[model samples]
Target: MMKRVTLGLFGAWLLHDAEEWFTLAPFSARKAASGGGQVGLPWMRREISEAHAHTAVALVGVVIAAASARGYRTEGRSRFYQAALAGFGLHGFSHLGMTVAERGYTPGVVTAPIVVLPFGYYAHRELARTGVARPGLRTALEGIAVAGGALAASHALAGMLHPATSAATP
Candidate 1:
């Protein structure tokens, strides 16, 4: 059960993020074109190109895969795996929260409730049922920090690998 949950994380992440991968660039483009004067939190306002979105998604996929593999290998005992699982759950909620805050659809919002949230909840419950140590505050915090750092790095790396065209609107 734990093994299935661990592997399921990867599949769930891919499904959730694939929504973002396909929709984010176009959504940002539309939002920019509408002159809506930035939406949601300030940090969410940055417009990105399709290339950047693709690269970032691909990069993060690797991290998710590594975390899932670690979880499977350790049978939910690895700290990193626990942190990643917690982070994934948090991230799923964030998508829903962001959509509500924006009062509109956001990339990955569709899958957040369907795939990401459900999988996160089910995985955590199964892990607990199987005698895996329940995640503590430290694990949750670590998950958030690690996920944030990875996302930042992925964005940075994407920028470097796929420089924005000057003609591209901000």
Candidate 2:
């Protein structure tokens, strides 16, 4: 059940990304028509086009899905799983921050509260219950660090692999 919760977090992230692609892409394009991928952050927005964003989201989803499967198979004790789980779960906060920062609707804003935050909190508790991760400050901090690095790397790679382009936009 705990492992399932982790997987659900990943699924929620997938949906959130979709929401961003379909809706946020336009906003980003309008924000940066200068052909830079820096929509809101350095590692985000590989391109102004929604298609590029969609592709990036899909690739990252594959990574999360694979990591979640491996973690569940290993009884939710794998570092990859833990890091990915924690990283993805905590990722919801970024959306929330973005929404608040913009003071308006952002792509992932709609799902952040309803799906992302709840799933992350739920999975964190489930992991504790399953003994996959102990409840401790150090452990939590480590998990958070790994998550940050992983997200940064994923964002960087996604942009590098595809290269931001106006062609990706509608």
Candidate 3:
């Protein structure tokens, strides 16, 4: 059950991120084209190129895969795996909130409710059932912070790898 649950995290993340990867580029393009980019918070106003967006998603995938691997090897005993699972579960809420804030469909919003939340809940339940120790609130929060920081770093790396270009000449 632990093995299945651990592996399930990777599979579910793949599905959720696949949705994000495909939609993000197009969505950002549409927003930029419509001048919707200018109407949001400073962070939202920055538009990411398709390459950068996809690369960031891929980078996160690597992190998820590593966590899943560690969980599988440790048979759910690893604190890192426990924290990651808890963090991933809670991360789904961010997607829902993003959709609400945007007042429209957002990437990963669909899968957050269906795939991410359900898998996270099921995985956590199975972990508890198997007598694996919970990561505790502090570890869970740390996991979330790590995940968020990793995402930001991935985006920065992606940007460096594929810097956004402009048609206008200086």
Q: Candidate 1 vs candidate 2: which has greater TM-score?
A: 1
lDDT of 2 by residue, 1-46 (tens): 8557656756767776777768755766654564534335653332
Better of 1 and 2 by lDDT: 1
TM-score for each of the candidates: 0.91, 0.76, 0.89
Ranking by lDDT: 1, 3, 2
lDDT of 3 by residue, 18-131 (tens): 998988767776666666553332224455667877888999888889989999999988777777778788889988887787888777889999999999889988998889
lDDT of all the models against the reference? 0.80, 0.66, 0.78
Q: For model 1, name the residue pairs that clash.
A: none
Segments in model 3 whose C-alpha atoms lie over 4 Å from true places? 37-44, 165-170
**Model 2: residues with Cα > 4 Å off, grouped in runs:** 33-39, 43-47, 137-147, 164-170
Q: Compared with the true structure, what per-residue lDDT tens digits does model 1 show for residues 1-170? A: 88789988899999989998999778767766776324553224556788888888898889889999999999987788878888888888888887887788888899989998888889888888888856679988988987787788887787777775312455
Residue pairs with colliding backbones in model 3 are none
Give lDDT for model 3. 0.78
